[model samples]
Target: MKIIGIITSPRKEGNTAWIVNKILEGAKERGAETQVWYFGDLDIQPCRGCWGCHKGDRGCVIKDDMQKLNDAIDHANAIVFGSPIYMMQMSAQAKIFIDRMFARFSPRYSPYFKAENAAQKKLILAFNQGNPDSGLFQSYIDYTKHMFELLEFEVKEVPVVTGMRNGPAHEREDLRTLLKDIGSSLVGE
Candidate 1:
């Protein structure tokens, strides 16, 4: 199996990336190939809501970093998305990446999946939040979950670590263990 990890935190080597790496490490240990993409390094522009993809276009009308990212996403067997929470939601960087999925939008996605018998990919979400309050992160988590479902992917896991406003949240033992378990579960081992 192959897994593609998309890092959405602007902070390089931040807590979110640490956790996502652990999960990827676990997947690799289980003998899967993996690739990582950092959104912070890309110059992705936000969606214009043009609906160009709805008309049979396979890519975004905007010439930006999203198209390249989308190509990688299309080739991967599984996907991992990680981000830092901002205002109780994913960071602006993460939102831009999500909005870029417009390239895959259309009623044809369903028909295409059926015609090709699309592989059921394991979708994983990792989030680091500044707020320790669970309620503060629920909306973002819920939205991420919904996005995965709508994309026709099976949710393998969504593990969130909070209270990182001060330091590395993934350093906490609880969070590390949670991420490890999520990775292990994905491998069915």
Candidate 2:
């Protein structure tokens, strides 16, 4: 299985990155091909809402590194989206990446609204927050998961690492072990 880990955190060595990498490590150990992409290292532009993608099969007009991400998603059996909560929501990088995903969906908003890659690829949503309480953003987390489901992804898990202001995820052995297990579970083992 091919799994792609997308890190939307600006800090390559931040808590979110650490969590994503740890999970990817478990997948790698299970012999699953894995690749990690950092948003900070890509030149992905925000969607302009031009409806150009819907006009035909041209896809997003303002092409950039997002096309690479789209191609990766099309080929991946699973995807891990990792982001750090900013202002009680996903980071700007994550938001922009999600917005660019508009090209993957049908333009119709009726019952026919369907994503092009509606193959039910497994998805794992990972988030890190400074707040000590994990439930502080449960509602938003659920919303985000639902959004991915609407995009036709079979969301498998939503792991939130709280109290990150105290320390990075790399220092939390408990979380590391838990996340690694979660990742291993993705390969159905």
* Number of the predicted model whose TM-score against the real structure is largest: 2
Give each model's whole-structure lDDT: 0.74, 0.88
Off by over 4 Å in 2: 108-113
TM-score, candidate number 2:
0.95
Residue ranges of candidate 1 with Cα displaced over 4 Å:
107-119
Instruction: Kindly state the number of residue pairs that clash in model 2.
Output: 0
Model 2's lDDT to the true fold?
Answer: 0.88
Angstrom error at residue 184, model 1: 2.4
> For residues 110-137, could you state the per-residue lDDT of candidate 2 as single tens digits?
3346565745889999999999998999
Q: List the residue pairs that clash in candidate 1.
A: none
